[model samples]
Target: MMKKVRVERDKQGFWTHPQLPEWDESTTFADSKKWFSEKGLDCALVIMDGDLGEQWGNGEIDSCLAWEPEINIQDAYLVGIWDTEDGVVAMFAFPQIILEDSDKAAEFKTDISGWVSSDGRFYGKDERLARYAGSTHRKCDCGNIIPKNSYCNPCAEKRTKEKFLAMPVVAWDGASYIYDENTDKYFSNPEELVEHYAVDDLDSSSAMLIVCKPNYARQIEDDFWCDDLPEDISFDECGGVEQETISLLNKLNEKLKTTVLSYSPGDQRLDQSLLF
Candidate 1:
């Protein structure tokens, strides 16, 4: 009999250890490969445990998931070995010995496990192996793995949504913009935000907008709008704000038939909404 520490990949995609979070975290296939480089052990050959065993007879699997050759199931706790891109070489990390004509026997417990007499396999679930090796499943041209159908469910739905997005839409004129890292794009329209950076506010420091008209002289003498007091500005250019100087521009532009200026907010001479 051998010992086995069962691990399960959780719903959140984490392989947790029963007792040690840190230890379990290190067992990630990616991390396992990284450890070798960090410790300068990349050149070391892996001395895998367990060897090809004799066959086990019918009906004696005390260990969980013990490989049953009669059914082509694994015998024991086979540690799935992932390759450079995962699914490299599959190994049976099992070790319990079985007697009598065993093609391949997996132990629920340990000693070590054996590999087939060839290469290029990774220890993974049947579905996973089927997906990667095209053993029992096929890949969509979209690169989605599916048991059947021209497209995976997700790919089909994605295409449908893409068509929906392609439909013409009324353009919105909003000033804000967002940057998408995945696509390296800048797009407006708040409805399309996804995975945006956490920067809540963008500052355009002391920014102001001045509405201008077409065909105007570029350097025409215009009133300067400043948040702070300017030393050389004439009071007339300040919209003649003083009640005494208000007559300088005139109460109305008689030629244009529009109010030249209305200093009072309550002035109902013109429709404020229409002015906008």
Candidate 2:
């Protein structure tokens, strides 16, 4: 015949074992079976106080358990059981560190029997416990508020590519290029002069040189070359070039002249040769 077991709390608010000297304070779930073996107990059961539900703010009960310092208590629940060889065991007391409210505690008491079995095991109330356990509310690394089901709004927003050509361009043969569908043309360096100046003519080989405004003697040398051409071949003289190439070079020259005039405080001699 199965023996009947009873559990009672002591004056110090700990549950007393019926047969064992005292409840093992260092017990863990992994060692529960071993604890039974050493103490000659068959099985055990756990009971939780209803009050702990309120103490776990944000509907997070698992956090309380995970954050528990002592193994004896977890989220205000009384845990541990000892079943004897004759199928009789006593309940051990292990309470959560935080206390719950009276109203919440009352609700738990009303449904305690439904949740706890006569054999000292917990059942039938896992849904409610899981609802509280799975609650997650926190901020993401990008300073965006994250909810239970999704990431932070700001983080999602930041991940989107606003620009049409958001893909990173890997430089092959020391040249980086991106195809712009808006203009139906390829930009050699989209992040530089073309984007900043809003000019479409400049290819990848455009150069910026500082020279005097009226320096006709110091002509701007056209030394820029394409990747496939030899060192002797100039950008302008390259065969099968696009019409925009000349326009871009002219614009670059205009910018260089304007920049030089702004910095040259006095009337400077214009080297005509420098304007190559």
Q: How accurate locally, in lDDT, is each candidate? A: 0.32, 0.37
Using all chains and alpha carbons, the TM-scores for the candidates as numbered come to 0.19, 0.17
Clashes, model 1: 22
Candidate 2 local lDDT, 21-51, one digit each (tens): 3545465645764555443233435433344
lDDT of 1 by residue, 176-225 (tens): 34333223344443444322322433222211111111222222122433
Give me the candidate number with maximum TM-score.
1
RMSD of 2: 26.6
Give the Å error, residue 128, model 1: 26
- Please estimate how well model 1 matches the true structure, expressed as its whole-model Cα lDDT: 0.32
Going through the candidates in the order shown, the clash numbers are: 22, 29
Stretches of candidate 1 above 4 Å error? 1-5, 8-78, 81-145, 149-154, 157-161, 173-276
